[model samples]
Target: MSPTVDHYRIVPELTVPGYASDALKAIVGATHAAVQANVDNLGAGTPSRAPRFVKLLRDKQIVDDKNQSIATTNHNETVSALRDIEASMDVNDEGVDSSTYGTYSVAGDAYVDIEKAVNQLQGTINDAENAPGPSVDAAGRQYWPEAVEGPLRTACATTAATVEQRMWDATTDIQRHAEHINNSAPDNPTSSGYGGTTAPLTTPWSGHSYVPPADAGTIDKIKGFAANELGVAETGTNHVNRPYNIDDAWCASFATWVWKQSGINVDWSNKNYVPSVWSDAAGKGWADSDMSSARPGDLVVFGGQHHIGVVVARNGNSITTIEGNSGDAVRQHTYNLAGGNFTGVIHPPAKTPVNA
Candidate 1:
């Protein structure tokens, strides 16, 4: 009577047929559709939602990792290449045969070329390994891989490893070839005339004649004779010659000894006196007043004709001499011509004719 205040009575009117069942089915269908829509939107979010700096850092890290891997691989490859080169070298005689490389000698032009190439390759590796580290730009961005790209990448890119291996192989082959040539070479070649009919005298001075061998008067011969007496000293156990005691100053005697060894007939009353040698040289017309014209095998008088020695070598304004009584033993000395009281240089006579 009060306008259907009981709601149960209204629902019962709808339930008279399949009305309740239809309402439940409609509600279940709506729920299923909403769930499926949410599932479709999963994993579709943008990275831009994150901070800009974080994104930049992440990208930089990824690039750095990749570059590091590249650098490591390059380094290992370079080392392996070098090792391969070393292993290919052979130090045997067959390796250096001229027929092998179409060259007579392994130390010739071909070897030089190989050496240069190998050195260049090694330099590339050294440069890359020692290159500077990464750099930071104005905006806090980092940069690397420049040096690696410059030398390392270029060296390892092409047939460089093959070239390096070949170079090393050639180097070893040449070394072996050089050894073969040296071993097979004659002790004295025909050009040197050492073992030929025209060979110079090899006999020691017999004192029967004052004439030296044809080659004995040369600068090299004089230096050789003086060099032989390098350690000789005035010792009581062994003296060089009579009237020339080891205790006494033997500079003049040493000069005379060298001259005698060279087969030069020197007549001196007092062999211990330097002035005597000078006077004898002057009388023989062997004295050269100009110091600049001094040659090897020439006599040099120093300290007012007090000390004397044989000139071994000369350069502009400087001279090397082999002297006795220097530090009480025969030794070489270098002097400046401008500072010392260097007297005239005396040239020894050329090879004297042997008395027939």
Candidate 2:
């Protein structure tokens, strides 16, 4: 630490004497030690604790400055802030106030805690290097924390990163576990079915409709209209090599037919872009969206060489789409699993569309 850039120097008047120098020195020393410990954190096998790097920052404050009071102040401030943040992470103003209530708890402290954790890491690491030694704890486990000049820092860092990553992985794991449980149980169905039949979730379902499909066979009825009634072309595609079969990959045509049956208007003559009973009519784009106004029969078109489907139901990432050309079967399928040849979807025009 030769020719250290005096932080107090920048604040001219503070460089005068005792108070300024003392404060600056204390802060600088604490900061330096924190950095050192952080470096040690980069070690292969090093001693560590939770509030992980945060604890290191507080502990090192004392080690670097030998000022117990200062360290305590810094540490308590951090801890208090952390706790407040944690508490705040889930706030609800719905206390005796109807307008203030919400469907879910607010992000009371996550934003703050996450920010503090990040700032703590940056503040310490930016100023100093790692501290040293073979770290041992009561548990008798050893770690290679980054020492001021040893290979420890790398190890500690790798470990911290690993732990952080693991934490992230755990969150995903929880979500996946929940998904698995949901998938495993038949009682807690995945998607809300059209007529008491649940399917896997995929896209968003928002609008509430009192009218169920006039009939489950409504899906088939729509297709029949497109095939025998509407002048829809039975176009073939070299999409995957062979040609189009009425029984396979006829998703676009099937959807086109269904949209028309539900009283949703589609420009059947327009082959390049299928006239969605929804988008072309309702005006919802892929940009920023708000479907609070979307109705039941609106067409949700999946753009790509004219592929489309009908939105049977809408609830984010869990849409119920009725389609025809889905791998050789025309049935209701999930949006999430809509892969390969499956494109986007079309919300059909409601039962009241003029041209529908």
Candidate 3:
């Protein structure tokens, strides 16, 4: 037997025969259709628990909190852009005389703005769909049962590609009509916005082009503190003279010290135990599993939840961390993110540095 396939609305390409307003109306309809298709793909109207797609988005850190979902946020942004485009157009026949009809035109910038919004939404959808889902242990305990999530993921991908392409085609329709319209449109505006950022620096002492100064934020200051202690070693034997007055394992202690020195308040009692500190950070909504966007100074819990370190830099799967007791000394080491030991990344509380 064959499998069932759900059919969705396919927005047709716009063809403006008379005025730019004609094209604008078609584009607006296409945008709305795209929005509806995404909503359906994400299972918005379902009566049960949140759909697996929504859960995956939250798990991947694409959506920051449990209350927000990827589809609804993009839907709202795209709809807002459509409303602005509509408002900028002359659609009413209020008081214009029959002899002199108002020019049916939209601001070229308005069309460009909508195009940008759609392009952004498309990229967001692609990222959420491609991000790695939650992990499952060998005991077969799943974060989300694959039986439920697998089909949803496949369907969402198909719908996203179809709807996002429709949205892009709407932009193309705008460009084709704008050439004939008197409004000032950009010359060959691509689907991409502005330009892409440079890759992160891999070597130590090499500065990142996108990063602010060490004193710019609390996180940077924490990283700066760790970076300053890169070669400090234990003064006594058997981890006795660990820095920060730590008695035993100093990884968590070093992490806490960096946090405090950078103006972040952590539970001093949780300083020695890595799991305890991880739990505390999780309770504060600071623990995240999205390693791809992990920021410098994020406390990384790893090695079977036994060790912790401050992230100094990351590029792709490579993470550079400065640890307090890797070889009885403060040293920089690299770790692959694909390794299962990378438990979580804790984002310390954000604060303005006194020097900034």
Candidate 4:
């Protein structure tokens, strides 16, 4: 026999009143787990539990007294029981009441996420800098599609060398906990201390002549390669699905496949580009530039850095751009607005920056 829990207030959700305390932990765990799990698996732009869970918890006196809704306050005992639980939550960034848990402030949550993103970016830059080149051609020009510059200077990579060193030095001026995340740390022990940076100075092939594989045959072949090799996220639904809709966005995966083919190298961790986020600078976006200025074969970025397309022909407002995840296969679209998802364009190198 055990002492019965006397209810000062009613809990409609939990029939067994004595066991409600144990269930409280599980609900909190479920809510928190949803957030952490999204960060661990999805990486960006994921939603968690909706408002109903919070309301139910509030009504049951499972949250803290301060956080309980005015409705929950109708019962005096419910309000009193939640007081301790809310106190416990005070230690964490998020505060909880007897019946409900509060989320972190927008700025507070963003800080930690930015930190993880920087970690990922650093590892990527390191790998790209160290990745081996394809081979040196007869002209003696160094040819490594994926090579990145290291923090320290080395022989094979000059442009990457400059970029790494610049990114390294740029961190000195950054302020606040979140702004510091933009600058990935340096290997130099001095840089690890507060107020340090090594920023990107020069891009790959900035001054060198980087030659892309010239004899890829034809533009149509590239289209075939893009369509056949890459998954275009298809327009229509499967056997049983919704109609072809704007809700479908296949821009990132298309860009990833094209970048691989062109060899304008960068490190891709998951191999597939994440579509849910417009940030991360990973998708097919470009900067604002005139149609006439963009050359043939230049990769046009769009959508604040989301979708990308390859230029084929241009005539003032009308331009033909090859895209993988639009209309049908890798086909051409014409428009002055650049399909509305416009951001910027990145021109692939015909010759190394040093040589050109």
Candidate 5:
């Protein structure tokens, strides 16, 4: 008896385009295996071999047909979707309508929240764009742009120049004043030390200048008294009354008279001896033996304390003096330290004594 062959038919179903070719290949392989098994059993003499071969061939053809149908459907679906997108994108200057793309209206609360976020973002951008101008740090230093810094620098430079100019003006004024003091002369004939013109003979001297002390008023008073007596001789009626006659040595008397007129009290009052002035200064601790330590208005004792004069100015080794009895009248004289005529200097108190 012949064995019965059960023939199973494969029906093609609609599959996704991606898996259609793989499914078709699997169906063809199964048909080929079934035909191979039937032929191996039937051999060349069996009539069933041709029928089984035809059936396998028919199954492979059906799977190929199904694969083609699936490919065509997928292509059509893609074309339809693309055409719908193109139609929706069709615009004519009138902006995209909500109808063609799909209506999308934000909820009221969500719209308000998004608007607030956008405003905050805009505020941040504005702050970044419009920043503050130049400022100063806590350390009192200025940090500024070149535009502001330029004017400040110029102002500082201008102020500095002005200050320098003022300093130069002050210096010139001081020099002129020194010259005036150096050139001044006594007006009266009896005031000449040697009974001649009381004007200074040498050119105005220059050297380190010093600040006049508070009692400089006393010096001014002494100078004024000496100037008032200029050109008057000891024999003249304007001379101060002394214990001795007008012809005797009046230098010491004249110095004491000037001091008296200036309201200054000294031990050598109404006395003609010059050494007494040095003694008084020594007793009072107002004497300076060093000539270089002498300042204007100091009493200059000369000829080993034989003569005394008021110092007008000091320039290096030279000193200008206003003296009485120099050539028999009040006069201005310039003396050199090298001459060894200057013995000592007597310093007057800066303030007059209240009692004396």
Candidate 6:
């Protein structure tokens, strides 16, 4: 153990000429060595211990140059402070903390311990960096609050941005996983009942008839609403209601509901009829056969408008969608762009003063 020099007083007036100087030098050297040893052990130890040690060292003023053998009063206080800190650190024969110091009680809880320790350190750093500084005037009106909160606020803002990006990535992963599980299940029971449709079809557009607006606010709302409806199963047998008061075959109604809720003035004349949606879009020059130009929020017509869904994503030859009344629930689907079932895509026009 490094020697405790608190009891070894050094007053230049009372001691021999050169003796006090030598004694103070020896104490300072030993204290410095003990501090270095503590730091080394902490760096090699568990994560939480090192930061706590650093914080305490600063708090106790043991790491200050002003405490190094100044006058009798300051020198004695420094020595005593060093003693207190060394004891707290459980310094041993090697001038290091106890072997078990700052260790997790259970190895399995190490991750939790490390996380808590990081949070504690972060809080301290934030507090130190954000509080009003000495430069602030007595009235506290000289500088902006942002200037005082700059470092901590910046740290939190950056962390918030990263967290948002990660959350989005996680949502995408969950969507893909749900799609995979739904795809692996048996064919949608309600999907096979589309053969009896008899609505007159509009002539399929040969090329792009209308380009969607540049802003994506409405499209984002459409996709958001559809995503929120995932797993909303039909309440009872053929009793699905996509706000159409319908009992069955509500795929078109579901698509219409999503569009209407997203602030698009969709035709509700034949809201439950799949082909009615296609014909309206066709007549309004909103229909297109180009799968490559398809986008989220577009109504995707399947089997020549025999069935319909709201497009949520498109990648190469793969299109992902959400359709209601599929297996008696709102379910996600991913189909090939060149698949036989995919007939066309529709870009609905937004109502005036579109929802922002």
Give the top-scoring candidate (lDDT). Answer: 6
Off by over 4 Å in 4: 1-249, 268-292, 304-306, 337-341, 349-356
C-alpha lDDT (0 to 100) for residue 246 of candidate 2: 41
**Residue 47 of candidate 2: its Cα lDDT?**
15
Question: lDDT by residue for model 6 over 1-356, one digit each (tens)?
Answer: 34442211111111111212232323333333333333333322322222133333345553333222122335566556545654554343243323223332222233233334334435634454345432445775433233333333233223223322333343354346435543453333343343221212123212222233457577777887776666666668757433543775677778888887777866643677665566557656778877777777788877645578888877787767887767767777776665535668887664434332
1-356, model 4: which lDDT tens digit per residue?
00131211111121111212232223323333222222221122212211122333445544433332232223345434444333332222121111121132432354354334434433443454345423456886553321222221121122212222322232222123223331232211111121112222122212222244445533433343443322233335311121212333444445555555554443433223332222333233333355346654455655433345665556665555655444333344554644433554554443412111
For 3-47, candidate 2 gives per-residue lDDT tens digits of 332211111010111222232333333333333222222120111
TM match of model 6 to true structure? 0.38
Expressed as tens digits, the lDDT of each residue in 328-347 for candidate 3 is 55666666676535678987
Name the better of 1 and 2 by TM-score. 1
lDDT score, candidate 6, position 30: 34
lDDT of each: 0.44, 0.33, 0.47, 0.34, 0.44, 0.50
TM-scores, each model vs. reference: 0.36, 0.25, 0.38, 0.30, 0.36, 0.38
Off by over 4 Å in 6: 1-216, 241-245, 350-356
Runs of candidate 2 with Cα error greater than 4 angstroms are 1-249, 271-295, 303-306, 315-317, 336-356
Which runs in model 5 stand beyond 4 Å of their true positions?
Answer: 1-216, 236-247, 353-356
Candidate 3: where are CA atoms >4 Å away? 1-215, 240-243, 350-356
Candidate 5, residues 145-250, lDDT tens digits: the string is 4343233223222322332233334335434543453235222323233222346424322222233345657667666665555544345532533332345456
What order do you get sorting by lDDT, best first? 6, 3, 1, 5, 4, 2
Write the candidate numbers in order of decreasing TM-score: 6, 3, 1, 5, 4, 2
Cα RMSD (angstroms) for every candidate in the order listed: 36.3, 19.4, 25.1, 28.4, 51.7, 24.4
What is candidate 3's CA lDDT for residue 176? 54
- Candidate 1 lDDT over 101-192, as tens digits, reads 12233324333443354356445444533455345578865444444443333332221233334434544664464455434533212211
Q: In model 2, how large is the Cα lDDT of residue 267?
A: 67
